[model samples]
Target chain A: MVPLYWYLWLGSVVFAVGIFGFLTRRNIIIMFLSIELMLNGVNISLVALSHYMQDLRGQILVFFVIAVAAAEAAIGLAIIIAMFRNKATLHADEIAEMKG
Target chain B: MVEWFFGYLAGAVILLSILVVLSRNPVHSVLWMLLMFLHVAGLYLLLNAEFLAATQVIVYAGAILVLFLFVVMLLNLKEELRIKRFTGGWPFRLLIAAGILIILKKVLDGFKVGFKGPWSIEAIEQATHTKALGKVLFTEYILPFEIASLILLVAIIGAVFLAKKRLRT
Candidate 1:
């Protein structure tokens, strides 16, 4: 078996990339995708810890995380669509108007 | 052999995640994200979380990615293709990411895995990952599970409300 640290390192790297994308990307959808990436990163670590600790709770937590992520994606996309309808753009900076 | 498999899976996941973030076109990013999701499921399998592996694929790749594609197509992003790809201060953001990575590395280095639960790999395999998870989820974690369902219900209503067309003169 691979050392647990390997999985931790991998998760951290992916999370860093997600943070980078979320901060640097201008598109709302891409930012959302980056958030998914970050969530997956945390999922990796959760499963890794589950394996290391011989526990099933970590996996159960991951299952719930996936459920929440789905809900978030649905509502987030709807908001994106609503924003696009009102402002006619998907760029985060351009969608900054208060009264829409 | 197991180590090699894990290395390949982890590398693929990292590479695909990078591609998902860096792809100029949102459609391409979605595709890369699909691949990344698969790799994450593979990692879950490696960790013996078969149920989560399957859920990851079915929920994320199957349902969520399709929704993303629908939104991408609905938006008609031809004008967006001509705009600048990234936000300003990207270099500083990259530096911040690096700093976060370093901090996480230090934290992980000092971390110790001390907990030894009743469920071992052999025990879980014998009971089956899905069965064990369902037993705990429906019994011990039932309240949170129900709350999760409620959250999803709220999300459904919110999505519909947000996307509904207004009736106007």
Candidate 2:
């Protein structure tokens, strides 16, 4: 049997990779996909814990998280499209209107 | 026996996620993400989450990544595809990611789980994971379910409104 901590470690590693992508990657779409990666990583840990602990709450939370992620993807991509329309660029560095 | 399988899935997940991050071409990144999502669903199946495994494939792979690919192709991002993969001082960002992982490890070392629930593996298997999940979702968590539907509703309207062409005002 695989130890549960291995799953936990995988979760954290995946999340960290997502963070690395989000921070370092300049492409807006990649940054957005990185957020999705982070969510998936967290879901991995939650499901592992829920399975080990014999709990349904974690799965429920994962369900809601997936739903919310779907919603977030719709809204986020729409915004990305709108931004690309206005700015004509996908580089996050160029769109510094929010920066001081 | 299972350890080897777990190792393969884990290694694939980690590697694909890294590739998703590092690939210069956005379409390649999306395809890599598709592979990573499948491996992750495999992990879910290993954990006795058949429903989530299915949902992961259907929702994430079928729906979400398709949205990403649609956007990637629709946007015609020819210029950004050829540029450097990261912004300036990317090494520092890598350090930051490593630091965060270290912190996560330290924090997880002290983690202790409490209070086991009644949904044992056998119980779930007897009732089936889907039935039990539906029972709890429709009964105890009905309110939140409604809220989630509302959230999706809002998302639908919002996405349409935001993406729709508007005349200059």
Candidate 3:
């Protein structure tokens, strides 16, 4: 079997990719997807650690994180929809109207 | 054969994830993400966290991603997502991402790593994840669990309140 650190490497790579996507993407929805990617990356590491440590606390934490992620997505999407109604575009660049 | 299978699966998952990240169409990206989630669930099974694997599918695939698909459809964003556009950051962000990966690789490589705890493949076989995890969670982590549930409940209420358009007059 491969070492546990290898899993950590995979998780970190995914996390970095997610971070890059979030930073580069203009669309709010894509940004949300990137956040999900980061969360899933963390989930992978957590579950791996849980398995390796022979503990369930990590899994339990994942449960809570998932709950929070769902709630955040719901509320964020609602806000996005509201904004879309008032504004024609979903591009973050288009949000410059708020500039002081 | 095992190594080949793992390699292929990992490659497929990564490819789908990249597609999910790059695809302009939100619906297509969401579908790709669903596939990526399924692959991740498979990875959990390979890690021997069967209970976690099931939860990954049920919670992530069944619930979270479904919600994403719903919002994508509800917003009627198919044409809107097709507009070819990007944020302010372009090639610079990718350069930084590569730099971070390289630095991380070097740091991780420098560590003299050994599994300090009982993490053998054989040791994992004896420990039932669901049973052992339940025992610990209920006995030691009970307080934390209750606290988390309470917080989630409050968040749920907050979400409902925020989603409401107007106060009843």
Interface RMSD of each: 0.7, 0.9, 2.5
- The native-contact fraction of candidate 3 is 0.38
Task: Provide the lDDT at B117 for model 1.
Answer: 93
TM-score values for chain B across all models: 0.97, 0.95, 0.87
Ranking by DockQ: 1, 2, 3
Q: Report the candidate with higher TM-score, 2 versus 3.
A: 2
TM-scores, all candidates, are: 0.98, 0.97, 0.87
Q: lDDT value for candidate 3?
A: 0.75
The CAPRI class of candidate 2 is: high
Model 3 Cα lDDT, one tens digit per residue, B1-169 = 5556556666767677778778878888889888988888887887777877788789888987887788777776755757765565668998887788788788767755434454445654566567666766788788887887777777677667655676569
State which docking tier applies to candidate 1: high
Angstrom error at residue B123, model 1: 1.1
Per-residue error for B106 in candidate 1, Å, reads 0.6
lDDT of 1 by residue, B26-124 (tens): 999999999999999998888888888899889999999999999998888999889988887999999999999999999998999996998898998
Candidate-wise lDDT, in order: 0.92, 0.93, 0.75
Ten consecutive residues with minimal summed lDDT in candidate 2 chain B? B107-116
Please tell me which model should have the higher DockQ, number 1 or number 2: 1
